[model samples]
Target: MTEHKPGGDLTLGGQRVHERLTREEPDLVARVLARIQAEVADYRRLPVEELAGDIARITQQTVRAFARCLREDRDLNAAELRQIGASAVRRAEEGFPLEAVLAAYHVGTREIFAVGSADAGSADVADLLEVADRTLAFVGTVTGAVTRGYLEELRTKIGQEHTARRTLLSVLADGGPVDAVARSAGIALPARYLVLSVELGPHADEATPGIDADIAIRRKLRRFLAAFEHSCGDGVLASLDGPGGLVLLPLAGRLSAVPEWGSLLGTAGRAAGVDVLAAADTAAPSEVREVAGRTGEVLDVLRWFGRPPGLYRLDDVLVEYQLTRPGEARDRLAAVLAPLDAHPELVETLSTYLELDTNRRRTAARLHVHPNTVDYRLRRVRDLTDIDPLHPAGLPRIIAALAARRASLPR
Candidate 1:
């Protein structure tokens, strides 16, 4: 391609006109165009030293592009306009304002034309200036609107990506994040404890009523966690899985960060009318099965012991609960377990059966009853409640009931 010839710097018009265009037009395109050719930087001359340096830089880029188009007679066709429009659309899609970018162009055009017209170039210079003005105005409008449309699509994609990321974190916290793609967000999660909080509040029931997990509640939880992060100090944060999703908080040490977390949780949970349980990692990680198992056991104590539900600190009370039938009543315990004695065998049988691996033969052997006797007792057991003792999950409930029974059992 032939190199374009360079042009003269814009001359301030005699006295009156000189000052008008000089202060207004920063990029003197007319002066650059006068020589019939302009180098890239020739369009960058500015008057006011104001706006720091940004105005000069933006104007420089635009002037260069406009000048290049002028010299090459580059057609601002469907493709170019669409691309520009797409750019504008993308911004709109991103939930950003379009008017700002377009307004800058408006200011830039007035500046360029006023300066350019003051200087002489060709017989058609006036016409060229007018056409340039109209084209840019049209381009600004088209590009801005088009970009917003694209931005709408762009934000939607971003929102989806955010949701997917949240889901992945849920997996990672539960055990591991899975996808065909790579996840390398700059967060470190080494939680010994995992708590899942569902966003709930005056609005929760009203929002996402059918979805089970409310979007607004999730947003609140996210905001709460973000606030909690600084207090977490060495903690890692991931997006909440959803209203029902869990958050994995890897403690730095034995409940090191948990003690400090109450106030923050209190403020956050108050809005929801209930504290979020931040469920235990309802499953185990293949990698840290043992530690996870211990953690799971600790969570069981918290859930069954009837401690108020919002947030519980296991590391501190863990040893106490781990020492016995989760710290229950005996003779003084009968005064303690008098409440549980009302359903004495219900609790006793469950506790004993679980201790014996839910095997009828072993439970019978442990309870010192005939195997048939154990079967009969279990049948009476099933008849009283919806809980199915034969099932493994019944362990948590069975254990708690027994503890409550142990609390109420007679001397």
Candidate 2:
């Protein structure tokens, strides 16, 4: 074990000061504790029992160790340094901030020096200087140990929390014992959750040949997560990657409106500098697995139809969503558009005409053709399908047929 020696060898005067500090050790410990609590707000907020028990004991041991180092004319050995670091780990586990932990040590050291040097006269200059130098050395070593230990523990703790959250989300998305998983994760299962299945469009940087696409994706993900945290409080559980992921927002009992969460997609997209699409639904805790499945299906439906980026619920694309379902009805509707498929131009014209709300001029403008050409195409469609494009009754069928056709095509 390496022993840290605080510079010069201890002289007779340094020994005299150490003796005085040893005699006042008990009182000095008390003074250190009181001063730490008084000066550091974190310590002051600790419960009385903890303040008197663990904190007091640790403070006393630290003071004794410091005095012993001075008396032995050497600094803490590796084992003693490890002990100080272990105490810092304990403080981290107890949710003590690293700054507060360091503050406690600083306050303790100041009090120790003040008390040990209280009785020194002008003739005791060498003794006081030795004490000051030793105090600085001890503080430097102790603070470094505390910082390293606290940060290491904090990193481990954060990793554990992230793993737990992912586990909880997976169990909620798939079939599992949600209650037990939630317990293990130390998260309360809300009565209801707003489930979102997200898809992210590629950022421009992803296409730049010189740029690392993975790095761009990762940056977008970080921006997205930050946006989510800012818009929605930290209780949101999400599992996301570079492209996209799933999110589950815990809804407060009758207080949280689901629509509020739907707005997050736009904010997230803008922050990430990418287009975003999400399919959202609300479900109770028990129904999360089923609801998640449906939400993903809805998102798939949106992508199949080439819908614009935004938040979509089942209702947003109800007709298209239902038409894509496998059934005799969907097959029949898809067949309705098959006749016009032989003439690709007619099919294109009909689709553009309907999309333009039957405005022949707008359809003509979009197709870059004369209005007469659009009329001729519609007539050709009517001739082949025997479905009048102008009739209100036929309009519904044509629209449904178009949706069915688009849904059936290769995605």
- TM-score, each model? 0.43, 0.74
Clashes of 2: 0
lDDT tens digits, residue span 89-130, model 1: 544544544455455455555555555455545654544444
Candidate 1 wrong stretches, greater than 4 Å = 1-26, 29-76, 82-110, 113-171, 174-222, 225-244, 249-257, 270-274, 278-306, 315-411
What shift in Å separates residue 285 of candidate 2 from its native position after superposition? Answer: 1.8
Task: After superposing candidate 2 on the true structure, give the runs of residues whose Cα lies further than 4 Å from its correct spot.
Answer: 1-15, 117-133, 203-216, 226-234, 253-255, 270-274, 326-411
TM-score: model 2 vs. ground truth: 0.74
Best by lDDT: 2
Alpha-carbon local distance difference test for all models = 0.48, 0.82
